[model samples]
Target: MLNDFLSHLFPRVVLRRNLAFSYTFCLGGLAFGAFLLLLLSGMLLLFYYQAAPDKAYASILFLESSVWGGGYLRSLHRLCSHTLLVLLMLHTLRVVLTGAYQKPRHLNWVIGCLLMLLCVFEAYTGYLLPMDQLALWATQTGMELLAIFPCGPLLRGILVPDGIGQSMSLLRFYALHIMLVPLSVMGLSFLHFYRIRKNKGVLPYL
Candidate 1:
């Protein structure tokens, strides 16, 4: 039904292509698959995570020391998140250097920029999850930096509300790490690649 409707609306857009034999899938396709793996592993980790003072740290310790295959899952999640950041940066630079950001592709570039920021935001939020003294102090420093701005007061209400306190801040970070940032990045990624295909552009290999 959806395909019929799309065909009816844009009869000549040529939605179907014989991509099964194409090598183009090897690059972008694998990156997207990795992103999905990262998301799933991240969600699994979230289920066992705690955000409190002792509970959060102890939970991670339990995962590392006792839970079966817990260390591997945690390592996979961390590694993929870091890998995604690197791949995304390389993809962005490829587009820029290839002049794909010029003219009609400018909006795609904007979407790519947002996606990059979302990756960074996801990492920043996830860093505080371990709840170690280092994570706590680092988060504190970040909050203080935010507090330096006039908008900081408003952000503080959202970041660490009075009612929920420190745990609330943890919840907010978790939401951003697992939900908000990932969703935004995924959406922008779709737009970015769709535009790339529409432009019939190949990024030059360095």
Candidate 2:
């Protein structure tokens, strides 16, 4: 039954030479793998994380210093998040260079672009959750940079209500980083993969 469903979603030709499975150098699969790693590690970290401004940093410290494997999990999460960005960019460049975005694949290309942006946003939100000096200043600087845009104030308000370093702001970032953004990314990833199959898989190797 599962095989039939998958076969219905993906043509046999596409499945036979799946880009995700066959391409040795392509980083799309690696990006997806990294995302999965981030998801698992992030979930584990959540058990020990505190979203309040006062406790956030201290909790992280405890997690690292005391909790078994917590430090490694956090490191893995951070590493995968960074690695996913690089791999996604490389995969996108490969697609563009191969003219894979042409014709029926245009929608999937657009979806991929949105996924990349969401990945960046996910990373940014998580960055602020650590609530340390670096996270605080980095988030503040990011908001300040956003202020350069026409609707920067509105965007900043939406992202960091009550301003940076505040409890509410930390909570907002936590919600987005852990729940909303990840869910949206997962949904888009499903659509992106489905579209790839619908489009009869990736472009031929260039």
Candidate 3:
């Protein structure tokens, strides 16, 4: 029924028989489902989440202790982020093991990889918003790890001009987490979906 509706809207759209439930495991679909949950919960979080360094942790505490269901909402967001990353990895692995990354599907494979990276980056940005001890130490450690990369210092400077756990860094992470990264992910996801739809289905093994 869902395929029929999509086919009605896009007459050329097709799903080959090989796209059976067992073969695909619907990993991509599950990842998108997790993304949708994260998007919704994160948006709801924005209503009460203060990005200021001084109030960041306080805001989280307030939400958890005061707002009904706020803690559960935050937990859901965190869980979905992890779930999406895991699902992406599984999806990528499945593609590799099945040779789905060959020929015309290579572009979509790259998009999938980019989506995974974007999701990881999104998690990193969100990890620091709480401004707690663990967040500070973890972010500082991540920056150190990043510093070892080529042009790492330059990139780190751009990401955290005032240093990790500082006001400026908090604001930067907040902006990237809430706006930039999400927009990039959404745009790339659209491209990925379009490519898949255009290609119709995984091509027969050459």
Query: Highest lDDT: which candidate?
Result: 3
The per-prediction tally of clashing pairs is: 0, 0, 0
Q: What value does the lDDT take at residue 204 in candidate 2?
A: 57
Highest TM-score model number: 3
For residue 157, what is the lDDT in candidate 3?
98
lDDT of 2 by residue, 49-107 (tens): 98888898999999999999888989999999999999998998888877888887889
> Per TM-score, what order, best first?
3, 2, 1
Off by over 4 Å in 1: 1-30, 162-165, 201-206
lDDT score for residue 142 of model 2: 93
Local accuracy of candidate 1 as per-residue lDDT tens digits, 1-206: 34433342245644345334443334444556668888899888977888675588899999888889899999999898888777777767766666767777788788778877877778878888898878877777777788889999788678777422266777788788878888887777666656655655444221
Residue 139 of model 2 has an lDDT of: 95
Q: Please, what are the lDDT tens digits per residue for candidate 3 over residues 119-205?
A: 999999999998899999999999999999999999999999998988888999999999999999977777777777667655551
lDDT of candidate 2 at residue 25, scale 0 to 100:
74
Models 1 onward score TM values of 0.77, 0.88, 0.90
Candidate 3 residue spans exceeding 4 A from truth: 1-20, 201-206
Over all chains combined, what TM-score does candidate 2 have? 0.88
Model 2: residue 7 alpha-carbon error in angstroms: 5.9
| Candidate 2 Cα misplacement greater than 4 A, ranges | 1-24
Cα lDDT for residue 67, model 1? Answer: 86
